[model samples]
Target: MLNKLTDAQVKSATAEGQKQRKIADGGGLTLVIRSGSKTWWYRYRFAGKQKTYSIGTYPEVSLKEARAQRDEARRLLSENKDPVMARRTKGIRQQHDAENTFKAVAEDWLQNQETELAAETIRITRRRLENWVYPKLGTLPLTEIDPPAVLKVLRRIEDQGKHETAHRIRQRISQVYRFAISEGRAQWDPAGNLSGVLKTTPTQNRAAIIKPDELAGLLRAIDGYAGQPATCAALQLSPLVFLRPGELRMATWEEIDLDNWMWVVPGRRMKGTKKAKRAGQVPDHKIPLPRQAIEILQPLKQLTGHRDLVFESIKPGRPISDNTINSALRTMGYDSSRMVSHGFRSTASTLLHEMGWQPEIIELQLAHKQRNDVAAVYNRSARIQERTKMMQQWADYLDSLKQGADVVAINRR
Candidate 1:
């Protein structure tokens, strides 16, 4: 029995400041109301409950548009569902998606990335996520993330003067976002648009090898180091074998083939390369075992014999601290730039080259692949005899250098 809503009547009611009119045609409905303003709404009974939902302002929605919206709402209601509830459920879902936080995605990214990344890499990635990224943005979902939030996390680390860590964290976050997209967990990469948004800084390279002249000083210094004997031997051998710090620290008695004069670095312990998957053999490295090197190991065997590593730490089975080697170097008057424990490789490479040994032999001794192609395997024997002689001669050369004797190269070719 409601009258049709004419524009003139609608305007006249609004002007008179009357409570707005109600106009209904068939099942369609429109509400005109004023509370310091005129507006429209649709009212109906659903499941025996009355519900009134706004259809926007009267003039903006108009009579025709209001009727259309009313019909759509009723059609949805006829399906034994409440339109308001349906709309509420859709909104809840969108909210959930937008709330997918940084911490949750990062954990998922770390687990799925287990296969693609190296063990050491995985360890570091997880540590960074746990220690730095998680506490900051771990709860925020990616879709709702923006640059300012990301910059805030980065700037916190930067404020601590860990610019390098900050840069790496940003890079790690980007990688996580990429992984999320690939796994169908995310629809877009929020990290993609970040450019010039963060400051770029160069990180200093700290790897160093002691100079040839300084080897004598280092040897003499090791003799004086007040550290544990096992620490001393490991420090001395670091340069001689030039093994990776982890490889050196984790040396197990089971892996040593002293009879063959080879230390077979098992694949699990080695860094990735074609040879890493298969067992890689480090030749006896023919250490004539300097009296100093031998002396340090002899007594230490009785101490760490029960443990796996030749230089097991006081922490029972744990390997020595990553800083143990470098710290020993620093105590010996070498800074990171002067000499790093890893710099032994460069030291050996340079000294062997200076001693007039063939590049092939030195490179082979170094276990460096001459080419990247799979077909380019190292010729295991190109320098077997030469390396044996070179290592002994190199030991003697180090002795002479330590004694401040004029070093003369012996060509054992």
Candidate 2:
């Protein structure tokens, strides 16, 4: 077939009156010219229907290159194949590979974990992933991720003094890789075998003022804490309730009954396997509030009466921040080494045990659920009246210390 256009004509091609014009080069090859740009197009019949394929743009794709591509398309047609569909299939395959990036793969892994992971666990994890992992390598192809790249991300967190969190993120990354490998998407775990590369977080007991006199001093400091009312209340309530910091901050008004002087934290909020929490397979943790607890909650209701959370943070619709109580402790001259928010649980458990409260009663009050469900249920129901009495007495003892009266519990009832 005789070609109607040459390399020179196509290179200098332009549209007339701002309208697009097409220059045919025979055998289904054509040059499409617009006012500002020229593009190469391959027009042919596929499945008895006319179709146009954009080869590329001018200057970028020379006439010689365009003709070669056009020839390939005709060859495909002669072989009884649709060039458009074939090219589209190739494009789609490329897109699929691109979509298997680190972020995408990690998300797929997280979805798979949802069946067994708690909702809160999943939320915090995804937040950590988005904050720590995604910005570094979220868009990279999963197969292209290397140990060096993974280590770099972990080291960034370690630099911020979050060695434990760095380790956690690394573990999550490794888990994602394992999931990928199981599905045959990845052949290697980039996050594996670098465990010793980072500093090992030390295992140690939490700092606590287990002595009554020292505990008195800390209680006085909390009383004088002139910060946000919500934060101040959290500080005061922490020692009284002795719940985990997360459990304490997330306390909802519905969970506590001032009239009955009791609080019942649901299994969903209690720490457990994701499946157990989502399925409500775990039992509730109940607390018998002292009269003092009621005094605090009564006035607190006036401040946050309309809100869902009793300890709602300054930011509306959210619970008090995870770090708020500890940050407030810092404000009152208590550092992490001196007194962390979680130390309240340690202090309460130790002193309660020392004061001659039954180990089972103390453990039950602490919501230390046994691994066996039957034992946990028995522990939950044990000593209900005595637990209520102990809470009232504990509150009274704390008041005496705060009043600057030296006192000690030497015997149990």
Q: What TM-score would each prediction reach against the true structure?
A: 0.68, 0.71
Worst 10 residues of 1 by lDDT: 281-290
Q: Write the per-residue lDDT of candidate 2 for residues 1-413, one digit (tens) a residue.
A: 64677877876777976688988888888888888899989988877788998999998998888889988988898899888888899888678669878899999988998888866778989999999999989988787889999999999999998888898999999999999889888889988888889889867788877888889999999989898778888889889989999888899999989899999998778877867766656778888998878888899999997889998887898988889999998988888888999999898888878778888888888888677878887778777888887787788888988998665764357
Model-by-model lDDT, in order? 0.69, 0.86
| Top TM-score prediction, candidate number | 2
Runs with alpha carbons beyond 4 Å of true place in candidate 1: 1-86, 89-95, 115-119, 130-132, 147-167, 193-203, 207-209, 273-303, 369-377, 380-383, 406-412
Clashing pairs in 1: 100-141, 101-139, 101-140, 101-141, 103-138, 261-284
Taking the candidates one at a time, how many backbone clashes does each contain? 6, 2
Point out where model 2 deviates above 4 Å. 1-93, 110-124, 159-161, 181-184, 196-198, 204-207, 227-232, 301-309, 312-319, 405-408
Instruction: Tell me the tens digit of each residue's lDDT in model 1 across 108-166.
Output: 77777676566678798789878887887787777767777777888888888887788
Model 2 TM-score relative to the real fold = 0.71
